[model samples]
Target chain A: DQQVKQNSPSLSVQEGRISILNCDYTNSMFDYFLWYKKYPAEGPTFLISISSIKDKNEDGRFTVFLNKSAKHLSLHIVPSQPGDSAVYFCAASGGYGNKLVFGAGTILRVKS
Target chain B: EPEVTQTPSHQVTQMGQEVILRCVPISNHLYFYWYRQILGQKVEFLVSFYNNEISEKSEIFDDQFSVERPDGSNFTLKIRSTKLEDSAMYFCASTVQSEKLFFGSGTQLSVL
Candidate 1:
């Protein structure tokens, strides 16, 4: 399904810089947006999330911005570190099943 | 912190063989879900289970696929007859209310 899409397949950023990953969704019924980080040979780990009612959510160095009007969402990592290099996936929950729909994922490479 | 656990980190089976992937979700979580990701693809929802029954399933979950919580803490996905396309990483996730899904390390299945 093309409900969620991550147009950029990869992104590179220098350490201590801001890393922004973007995602878009065609389904307006989605109310909750989530970000996940995964390393090679591992499953995705929950990073952060935002609800449609709110514009932003932050935890530690990770932040998520949601623009419901544009059907877009983004994850921002401030002062990115090498440990932050991984595949990041954007997912949405809603639209009938309480099941999550995920994007193809964007690979983030934080260069030290 | 508690984390979801999956067994058989990798499994290689012949085509048409029946395979069962097992998972143990976090204790206190009320909802369970199964997702799969083919090589270089996005994670796709397979099924959601709650209260001893499957609440929802995706179109990808066809006649050959089934899910069960045979016990209080264990959840399992069964493929009656696996095909080459079935090869992928299977992740088990649990959440409290369709929010913040905690996922396991994943079980990689290879159907030959």
Candidate 2:
């Protein structure tokens, strides 16, 4: 079963606009959430992360907001640039061991 | 900045042949993990290793699959008697603490 899900397969937005990607999880035990961006033929690079204790986390142009009661999270990029056109994956993990459950990924296309 | 790296960007192997995929995680990271993604699918966790031993593994990690740190710098995954269903992109990741994972470019294995 897919514990983490990203229902949107693709999204398109104009440059300088806000781009939002959403994710949901069924497991309440997951205490950490992360977002990664991937380009074709390249590894996923760390974008931002949020702890269960906090409802939101922001880094540069990327912000992640988590809603524990709804088991939902989202990543928002402000002033989206063409370089932000890539697949974004949402991942969740519980305590220590370091195994992550990843979403199917959302392909974002920022048109210039 | 250090990043995880994998060798043999692409490999084509005959069914039933054994194959080995190698990875070198960040130098100072202490935890290691392996995940795989079939085309059009989400990334799935396979195993996690720490202190030279496997800490946890998913059901997908069967007898045919094995992981080893071999030496200080190299982490490898070996598949014995590979099957066509095993063909996928395998990623190696590492983390120093928390849930932030740095993933490698991945080795795309094709079993014919």
Candidate 3:
């Protein structure tokens, strides 16, 4: 299903720069949005999340911004490091976190 | 530091064979889920289990797919009959009625 989409297949950024990954969702029933980071052989690790009631949430170097009206959300990482080079996925929760629809994921390459 | 754990990181099976993927969700987590990602595809939800029963499932999770929590520590997904298209990385996740989903390392199933 095309309920959630990450149009960018990949992103490249330099160290000490900001890397933004964008996502869009057509489903309005979703209430929670999250970003997960995945290394080559590991499962996705939760980075940050935003509730529909809030516009932004931040933790450490990661921040998530939600624009309900625009049906979009973005993950911003400040001072990107080479260790952050991995696939980032955007997922949306539809029913109290019971079911999640994920985007195609964007590969972020951070160069030092 | 608790984490979801999955076994048999990779499995190769012939078409029509039955394969069971195993996972151990984080201790005390009440919700369990299975999601799969085919090569170059989005992560699609397969099913969600709560209170020892399936609460939700996706279209891709046809009759051939089943989930069970045989014990307090084990969650398993069984494919009654494998197909070539079933080849993908299957991730098991768990949460406690929240947005943060702790995912397992994933099992790479190759159906030949």
TM-score of chain A of each: 0.96, 0.98, 0.96
Candidate 2, CAPRI quality class derived from DockQ: medium
- Each model's number of backbone clashes? 0, 0, 0
Model 2: CA > 4 A from native? none
RMSD of each: 1.3, 1.0, 1.1
- Per-residue C-alpha lDDT of model 2 across residues B25-73, encoded as one tens digit per residue: 9999999999998887778999999999999999999999999999899
- Candidate 1 colliding pairs: none
After superposition, the stretches of candidate 3 with alpha carbons farther than 4 Å from their true spots are A95-97
Model 2 Cα lDDT, one tens digit per residue, A1-112: 8899999999999999999999999999999999999887777888999999999999899999999999999999998999999999999999656688899999999999
Candidate 3: the clashing residue pairs are none
Q: DockQ winner between 1 and 2, please give it.
A: 2
Estimate, for each residue in A1-112, the C-alpha lDDT of model 3 and write its tens digit: 6889999999999999999999999999999898988887679888888889999998999989999999999999998999999999999987565688899999999999
Write the residue-wise lDDT of candidate 1 on A1-112 in tens digits: 6999999999999999999999999998889999999998898999998989999999999999999889999999998999999999999988323888899999999999
TM-score of chain B of each: 0.97, 0.98, 0.98
TM-score for each candidate, following the candidate numbering: 0.97, 0.97, 0.97
Task: Give all candidates' CA lDDT scores.
Answer: 0.93, 0.93, 0.92
lDDT of 3 by residue, B36-57 (tens): 9887777888999998888989
